[model samples]
Target: MALDETTRQVNKRAVAALEAAVWGLREADVSVIKAVQPLEDLSNVTNAHDPALEELNALTVRIRAAREEVRRRWIAESEGER
Candidate 1:
């Protein structure tokens, strides 16, 4: 997707945090799982302001949702494995 540098960086960091959440789940790291919450919040802020930014914000929201879904699924799978 085409995004300005700021949007791109925000997306990158959000995805990275999401990935970290998944890894944290696997490792049972409370700190990492907690860290994802603020990252999600930052992701929300990154898209806040300006009508044109709405589209980018929406994209960021979708990406964040996807990340949450993956993290949830990872947790579920981990439970199932146990």
Candidate 2:
């Protein structure tokens, strides 16, 4: 998609934040992980400058969503068993 200038900027920022979060995770930077916690849907992050599509972008989003759902289900099941 042809993004407008503002969208391009936003996308750049999102991608940067996502990359920083990943690197922080690899480096075990707790602060960076906490900072990016709210931005769980990583697919919303884009990097047009990247030479190819990034699997990490989509994977993060999917993983975050699934994690949340799984957590909720686990909690509910545990509560039911109580």
Candidate 1 per-residue lDDT over residues 1-82, each given as its tens digit: 5567777576566667656876654454344445555655666777443444444455556656666777875565444431
Question: How far is 7's C-alpha from truth in model 1 (Å)?
Answer: 40
lDDT of 2 by residue, 1-82 (tens): 5567776676566556555554544444344354455354442575452322243445556656655555554454434431
The whole-model C-alpha lDDT of candidate 2 against the native structure comes to 0.49
Off by over 4 Å in 2: 1-53
Q: All predictions: root-mean-square deviation over Cα?
A: 16.6, 21.2
Write down the worst ten-residue block by lDDT for model 2. Answer: 47-56
Q: Please list all clashing residue pairs in model 2, or write none if there are none.
A: none
